[model samples]
Target: MLQEVAGIRIPDTQLAKDAADILREHGDNLLWNHSNRVFLFGAVNVRKTKQHYDLELLYVSALFHDLGLTKKFNSPDLRFEVDGANAARSFLQQYQIPDESIRLVWDAIALHTTPGVAEHKEPEVALLFSGVGLDVMGDGFEQFPADYREEIIKAFPRNNFKRDIIPAFYEGFKHKPETTFGNMKEDIVKHFRPNYKNKNFCDCILHSPWTE
Candidate 1:
């Protein structure tokens, strides 16, 4: 059965189901609920803004956006967002999804953590970022209708998300602190990992081996 929240219908295709199953298998209760909320919030934004988006593609992006935070998907040298995006790309390829759609989904997941720029991308990419922002940081929360927000939260209660999600972020980034040097993920490493040092980008460039 397709679930509808805030008048947006969740896709019920086999690919959608498979994506959900993969998430359920690897994601904890908090991660699963958060993923669903991301989808719902993104859907609501699409409807409220009267934006044209590929709903199924957005659904897949939302579901897989946080996979890199899971133990099953974590990588030692890539940003968690990139790990999650790569996982989504690999999954979609198995089903023969077109290259263009796969790229959109990849960008949507990879750039969900990036602000200002994501909103300028395709509708699905923009909506994914909007949804993630609303769920993770309450950005634009006031723009959503009250009853609709309530319904979405009821369906996927946050369950003390503020306390829980930070550790997940730390765990995902701690292994690849170098990769987060210029991005928001570096903040997590700086705060949680004791004595962690960030490699300065300018210093690296100045000391480059390419000196002629």
Candidate 2:
């Protein structure tokens, strides 16, 4: 609902508006609101760090970061992250966006859950991941002023995010359980599918065919 927060204004370009509409059409309200918060929180961090980034790129990445979780975008065999990334790539290509810019948004969405890696990428990528972390896990939460945090939430109310987000996550990847392997998403699978057994990396190595 907020067009501007902490000196950062939502990109009002037609492309950004279209992107928001696409997310709204395909994603539920939780994701719709969460995506906006991601951009706002990411923007705030950009200012805090005194770093320059393409607002449009960051905005698109934030908006589509959870898109893979939506019913329309979820895939049978791909990681939800990849599904989201591919959706963003296709949308950007439609506007004749350059490959480089598309790649940045794609990577930001795909690597957002990968923790150690995303934090070191391009500013857009790193900041998007940071924003998601702050929103979901409260990572680095203490750094943001309480009033600013209040403003962000007031703009996009969490509305039981603590409990709702779990089901939101589970439903996204539940059908593609194998895709969650070797990632934090495996935990989600295990939580919901009590009998779920994660594929062991060590087991894979031991079973792998080799002459050695």
Top TM-score model: 2
lDDT of 2 by residue, 1-212 (tens): 45787567889899999999999899988998888888888889887788878999999999999999988999899999999999999999999999999999999999999998999999999999999999999988999878878888988889999899989999998888999888898988888888998678998888889755
Q: Spell out the clash pairs found in candidate 1.
A: none
Residue-level lDDT for 8 in candidate 1: 78
In the predicted model 2, the residue pairs found to clash are none
Tens-place lDDT digits, model 1, residues 119-157: 899998999999999998899988888899999888888
Which residue ranges in model 2 land beyond 4 Å of their true spot?
none
Worst 10 residues of 1 by lDDT: 1-10
Cα-based lDDT at residue 16, candidate 2:
96
lDDT of 1: 0.89
Candidate 2 — what's its lDDT?
A: 0.91
Looking at model 2, residue 134 earns an lDDT score of 95
